[model samples]
Target chain A: MLTSGIILLEGGLLNPNPGLIFWTAISFFIVMLILSKFAWGPIVSMLEEREKGIQSAIDRAHSAKDEAEAILKKNKELLARADSEADRLIREGREYADKVRTELTEKAQQESQKMIAAAKDEIEQEKRRALDVLRNEVADMAVKGAEKIIRTALDAEKQKAVVDEMIRELAASRN
Target chain B: MRVKAISRILALVVPVLLSLNSHVFAVTAQAEAPVKESATAAAPAGPATVAAPEGVAPAEATATHEAEGAEKPGEVIMHHILDNKVYPIEPFGEIHLPEIAAKPFGIDISVTKHVVMVWLACAVLLVVGLTVGASFKSLSSKESPKGMANAIEALIDFIRTDVAKSNIGHGYEKFVPFLVTVFFFILICNLIGLIPYGATATGNINVTLTLALFTFVITQAAAFKAQGVKGYLQHLTAGTHWSLWIIMVPIEIIGQFTKPFALTIRLFANMTAGHIIIYSLIFIAFILKSYVVAMAVSVPFAIFIYLLELFVAFLQAFVFTMLSALFIGLATAHEGHDDHAVEGAHH
Candidate 1:
């Protein structure tokens, strides 16, 4: 066995073959051609399509994100505008209510003052009428009482002179 | 009287010559007797007739002849370069490897070890192809790929779409497989060659030539298919002046042959040169017979070259595929006016 092994080693070293080159080339070409036809075509194209698809999807996602962000920003802006508007309306309403309240108070005070002035004037007129009527009645009653007493007490000229003299004396005393 | 005296002297000389011949025969008979006895008898012994020169031993002469026979150093170099050996049993005797036998087909052959390696390479390619195919089959709706499948797909797609379709426009689908296969096969072969004790089929000139020949055949067929025979011949003329046909035809013909030749040489030289550099660097250890020097100098240099070879393997495959696509593109290009709008539009 050892002798045979030595012989084989020696034979290999002594006679190195070159023909492997030709056969290997043939086989390689055959394999490459067949595989290229069957396997490589689909694999490569599929991969390329996949790459392109992935790239496009990424682009689409990015654009969608940008659009969503823009929309969000617009919504935020709109929300801020609405808030400002609401604040503005509230401020205007408060100012309007304040103005209305001030005007109503001024009107109420003016109406009250007019009513008090009218009542005072009516009271004064009524008091004046009552005083005038009372004065007239007192004057009439005094004259009638004086006439009756004079008629009964004296006759003719003597009576007249005495009455006149008494009347003059009373008038002077009353005065 | 003088003639008679001469005759008498001749007679005396002839008798003496005859007597001397008999004496010589007797001496020869005495020498032959021992040799004849030794020839007849099993145990008969005699001194061997073959004589060695004085002062030099027989074994020493044989040693000298052996030293002379070993003088051809080129044979030793070639043996190391080309020889593939299978060590049937390990030095420790713990493992036994199958004996490698060469199977010859006609004058040519695949060595058992190389055949096994090649078959192994092919099997690897098959698995890779099937794996990639299966991944594609089971691909999800999600766009992204992960892991080895992703990597393989990326490489395959780069070759098919980027290299093949982008270069060879129009009927690129038909050629994608060819281009991809070549790229991967060569890539695999080159990588395998980098392995210890692996034979590089692509490194051989004949291998490269056969590959180039396939390209040549394909290119010619594509041209013929794209343009009829007359148109194809006219393509060779290239719408030049009728008077210039003589010069143009030969030049074009030469160009045709040169393309494939260049392809063959480029692949063969590129692949072989890397291996040669690596082998030569590693061989320094054996040539110098110093482990320390080899470790310090050759190992580092060899490693550097090896890394370069790795890059080269990929590059060579890419270049070969690219050039093939370019050639196919050129062959199938429309005759006469150069309107590359079709190609430009695809890109």
Candidate 2:
């Protein structure tokens, strides 16, 4: 049993086995080929794709945030512009209202002055007509007084007292 | 359901029984092993053979001579460590792997213990690779991979980032598949060796040597592709003076071969040594014929080392993969990177 052949066979932990080596080479290459096709290739690309997806998503988020900020800024500017426009319109409307009010007041003052002038002219015409009527009444009274004096002759002192009494009666009648 | 269960039970039991059968082979192998007279002569039989020198006991211990009580536990240890043609089981018959002859190559391509284990390792890799690949395919770009697929992906990423990319640099993508496959294959083989009735194919020189040879060829090819033939010769000269060519060329060439050589020996010795230590520890109990030693020292120490072997399995695989990538990186590196090319090698 201790034949040199068994020792040679058993002594082979160090020695090369061409058969095993051949199989090792074949199997290893086969494994590398199969795994390259079915395993490593797909996994690596997938992981890389995932990384890219994450990165792009981050970039998209950043851009979206910037866009939102830009829109907000534009809206704020628009709000400020609209506020100024409203203030300008309100100020112009007030100015126009004040102008219209002052112009209307001046026109009212001119119209009232014309109306007062017409009233004063009418009053003057009425006063002049009344004086004419009074003057005619006074002339009629003086004729009647002279007729009475012709009917009755009086002395100089009596004529003078009669004239005074006639004047008093005329004044009372005129009042 | 019952039949399916029964088949499942058979699936588990068969390999275990088959492995136990090797012990029956061990008994017969003990009888057929070297005699006491030739023990010293056949002492240095295997490469890096340890534990046998201490076992100067006779092969035939049946005579009950006080000397015969000192039996050849070394023979038993060798029987366990060495590759065999039969997949021996105790109660059931052994499965004999067929041997084919290639007359042109002068090679015997037989299915030995290590070969079957290598195939088993390949099979394991297939299931794992396919599973991880399937998960990657099924997962949406947004969704993270889960379970064993995720674990395997982490390892793959580690190899890609730490092993291939960091070591090989720019053209690293091309070598990822090769490095990843080698890492998992070697890891599976190392772990399978730790299993009961399992053989470490990496423990075999032919296996590691063939693997190292693959690395060597790829490295050379990459160098040729990257540097061209003139550059390759220049790389062999190591940018030294023409006067130093005699000293530098041979050393540089040897250095090229020695990297793979070291890789082969490092893995082979580590895997084989762990087993040898465990077996040697157990055999010490037998050699002393003491139950106290078996319980207190032998079993405990063996168990401890076995646990350590589990860690070593992963470590050795990582080392082999890391070294392979580093070598490829070193070889394919450009002319400007003469100094910093092997910076990763220090790690």
Candidate 3:
């Protein structure tokens, strides 16, 4: 115990030496000042610069991604619009074809009706001419027969009446 | 796997070798003690504290012999932990520092082994700092950090971002340089002790106290800046009843001083204790005076303690830096914290 006490007393290890403290304080301050100014200043700025570069790079990438996404959306929208437009055009084309076919059929029926009317008219005219010729012939025959019998020509009214009568008689017999 | 095996082998072999070596060392030391004492006695004009007295050497020698006989292992351990004027530079002779001003103002102003180690630590910091700073300057932006610059950058980034910025808040940038200096300086000083013939400067109470003093001053200055005179005084009141001001105020004031006191004691005790533990473990072989006990037990235990000391060195340095930042953070913190405290009190 005594020896230990003496060692503790003699050993100034626990005791704070002012000169050592002074030297330590001086050296620490010197290190802090020199390092803070020269070493730390530039290194920190460089780190900041690197961080800034990384941030800008990330920002650029984000913008590029946004732009690409926007373009993709636009392309999809255009595709959808084109798809709708094609559908409308196809429907319109089918409607137009149906309208054209209906109009052609109606016009063809009217044209055929008109042609039939003209043909009937043309037949009526030919019939009338033939009747006139037949009436004249019959009247001549009747006149000839009568002239053979009486040796005289008949009047125009009397001949017409006779022709009408003969014609009516012929139509009734054919029926 | 290989390293573990080798260490296991060392764990078995080293104690016996160490015990044998120390026994041989004890004999030489016994013989040499008289010669060193006679030399010191011859040089009587030497600064009293600078050259350790002849009278002390014989006592220490005999004390070691007693420790070998298991009479005073604790003293032997204490001697290893404490600072000395002479540094044993392993495989080479001792470096006896000159004592400058033996007792000016009733203080021992002798340069010690730890002081020389501190200077060496500072010199190393200067060289590395300059080299790293130069590398940062010369290297182009495109090139990544290489060699020492890379290693330094990692340390800088950790202290700046993790320690300083996280603790000190918004204006943390200003304190980064000082924090980095403190961290690396303490770390290097701690590491120096683990080397052969090297001393742990941070182990000394004087050195640690001086360092803590810087932190204390910086912290208080920050508090003063943030709080101003009125707010700073109000902070000391601890937001208690005026009746309790008598009790609370003094405690709050002591609290300020205790933070730095804690910092000093923590670092000093940690460094000293690690050394003492390692010495004690190694001394166990000397205490036993048995090769079997040395090989099987003390040597392996000492190696393990030595490795632990290595880890403690880094941990203690980091803790000191981190706590300093934390204290600075507390000092400069905003006033909203008080409102939160008031709200908590209502509950």
Per-candidate RMSD, Å: 20.8, 11.3, 7.8
lDDT of 2 at B68: 25
**Local error of candidate 1 at B17, Å?**
65
Rank all candidate structures by their lDDT, best first, as comma-separated numbers. 2, 3, 1
| lDDT of each residue in B132-219, candidate 2, tens digit only | 8988888888788889988999999899999999889989998999999999999999999998878889988889999899888888
Summarize candidate 3's per-residue lDDT along B77-100 as a digit string, tens digits.
444556667665534455678987
* Ten-residue stretch with the least lDDT total in model 2 chain A: A1-10
The clash count for each model shown is 2, 2, 0
Cα error, residue A134 of model 2, in Å, equals: 49
Q: Model 1, range A84-111, lDDT digits (tens) per residue?
A: 9999999999999999999999999999
Q: Estimate each model's TM-score.
A: 0.56, 0.65, 0.77
| Candidate no. 3 TM-score | 0.77
Candidate 1, pairs of clashing residues: A36-B177, A41-B177
- Clash count for candidate 1 is 2
Q: lDDT score of model 1? A: 0.62
Query: Which tens-of-lDDT digit does each residue in B206-292 have in candidate 1?
Result: 556666877888889998998879878998886889999999888778877877887877776566556555555555564444899
Off by over 4 Å in 2: A1-10, A58-175, B1-71, B90-93, B101-104, B336-347
Top-lDDT structure, candidate number = 2
The segments of candidate 3 whose C-alpha lies over 4 angstroms from its true place after superposition are A1-13, A86-91, A124-171, B1-71, B89-93, B102-106, B336-347
